[model samples]
Target: MDRVKLITIPKIEDTRGNLAVIEKESIPFEIKRVYYLYDVPTGAYRGAHAHKEQSEFLIALSGSFEVVLDDGIETRRIMLNKPNIGLFIPTMMWRELDNFSSGSVCLVLASDTFDESDYIREYDKFKLFKST
Candidate 1:
């Protein structure tokens, strides 16, 4: 029941600023889709569900936020405030994104396309699924 983990990507530094790169080799899974969450209202929350099969890597492109992960038995909280770091969220784990600062941008690199059948949106049902 391993929860989410922070992944450090290759960061190239220069006088201009810094750049981080995430390739297929850097992540555990092959990325099939890329999406980002931004313009979140102050103190708002997102990602109140869990994926059944799809895995994802989350990065904070700007500003900061926190992710709450639950694996039916234990819960953990991870803060995302750096663009060079990302969070790898495996399947069958519940995740919630909250405590978003203003102008925060959360980028997500997914392992699969959008599939409604792969999502478990209810906490009770997710717990039941884990019991099996």
Candidate 2:
């Protein structure tokens, strides 16, 4: 299975504020679509599915949240609370997002446009696909 890891977005520090860049070299894949989650209710979760062809880059743009990733055999949890850091989720990895703090904003950069056929939403189905 492919490994999930964190990538640091290059930051330019300034006395006024800071800037984080997500240009071509920022991530491995070209960003085809962009979206974000905001005002998520406490205890609510997001993204309980795996993709077949699309890769994703997730950033905690505002507050904090936890991401649980499973590669069929093993599971991992990561907390995102920084705007300049991001998590890269490759294809075939099942992920669940949770523990969103108030006002948390999650920015996602996708490698491809939305396609229902590319999603593997069931955990059982995900396991079966990984076993093959």
Candidate 3:
């Protein structure tokens, strides 16, 4: 609800396999850091936080997972199962990742390096911050 949307990463198909490509121009923000999630246990959760200034693009490199997005006033759930599609999350929106399938690989492209101060880990605090 907070302007979250999916991006289509151009892919080149062939008999051997398919290759999905993501360049600098594919995202709204310049990617400054990259990381991934893998081997997560079933029913385990990740990314229960919101950023104040940073944005992130998430891709399901393998298997599938669900992303829950909250904007203090509204919430939405999205499924990520395709390697050529991705989710873009803008600033100040609460996000949580769960419902991971076995062997799932989640790739994250970040707009900035890790910063402890930029994170809002509490839901109440995130709501208050959004209200202000």
Please report, in order, the local distance difference test score of every candidate based on alpha carbons.
0.93, 0.95, 0.96
- Per-residue lDDT tens digits for candidate 2, residues 18-118, read 99988999898999999999989988999999999999999999999999999988889999999999999999999999999989999999999999999
Candidate 1 C-alpha lDDT tens digits along 1-132: 464779898999999999888877899999999999999998789998999999999999999999999999999999999999999999998999999998999999999999999999999999999999
lDDT of 3 by residue, 1-132 (tens): 747989999999999999898887898999999999999999899999999999999999999999999999889999999999999999999999999999999999999999999999999999999999
Local error of candidate 1 at residue 29 (angstroms): 0.5
The lowest-lDDT stretch of 10 consecutive residues in candidate 3 is: 1-10
Off by over 4 Å in 3: none
In model 2, which residue pairs have backbone atoms overlapping below 3 Å? Answer: none
Per-residue error (Å), model 3, residue 61: 0.2
List TM-scores for all candidates, in order: 0.97, 0.98, 0.98
Compare candidates 1 and 3 on lDDT and give the better one: 3
Rate residue 65 of model 1 by lDDT. 97
Superposition TM-score, candidate 2 onto the true structure: 0.98
Q: Which has the greatest lDDT?
A: 3
